[model samples]
Target: MAEVTAEARIEAPTGKVWERLTDFGSYGEWNATHTNFPDGGPETLAAGSTFTENMKLMGFPAEVLWTIEELEDGRVLAIRGKGPMGVIVGTRYSLAEDGGATKVRIDGEFTGAAVSLMAGKLKDSATAALTESLRKLSGLVA
Candidate 1:
């Protein structure tokens, strides 16, 4: 298994940050790993919602069928998904309001026989992507 976590303190309220982060239509504009969302972001975010997303990881195009596992409005959103080659992937986005700023964190995990083969490279690539995504997101909302 490989895991990566990244966080950023954006100069904006949690509600403002959450609104931009969950905006599926503009996702490609600020999200670093986004390639496309065939079905788009969830019409409404809830625990049982599902979405199909196409993304690039380690410069390889892959698709993930994701099911929302948990939701807490502007505070948390977690999803578990199946990716190419039988890999299981999970990502969690957490937000907290700190005065006028929001502290956002993204935690991701990958597991499967395929993941083991390139765990080191995958971790590095994923970490960089997450960090860059947060930077872009921050710029958009802050």
Candidate 2:
């Protein structure tokens, strides 16, 4: 599996950051890098819940279908995404409490011919994008 993991330290409290991250419906409002969806939010934190969204990666449009596979309230969220071109992506969002801040970690695994072909370059770019996205999000909620 090809993987990319990125982390960011946000000056927001863990609870606040968790709420913003899980508020997938409004992600595009603050994170301009993501495609907007009217009803593209998580229905529930339970496993088996699914969410559909349109996303872009390195200027390529992608339809992301996420299935909630695991959850630990306020701490961890696990999702699996499927897309065209042999794409299978698993992502985990973890939140850790720090002094007056939140340490957020995002880890994703990509399995597909398209992803493997450009893993190294894609990983670096994706990581940077994630960092910036989180930073923007933090600023919005701060």
RMSD (Cα, Å) of model 2: 1.7
Off by over 4 Å in 1: none
Q: Score each candidate by Cα lDDT.
A: 0.93, 0.81
lDDT of 2 by residue, 57-106 (tens): 77888787889998999999998989779799788889999998999888
**What are the models' TM-scores?**
0.97, 0.90
| Global Cα lDDT for candidate 2 | 0.81
Best by lDDT: 1
Q: For model 1, give the 10-residue run with minimal summed lDDT.
A: 39-48
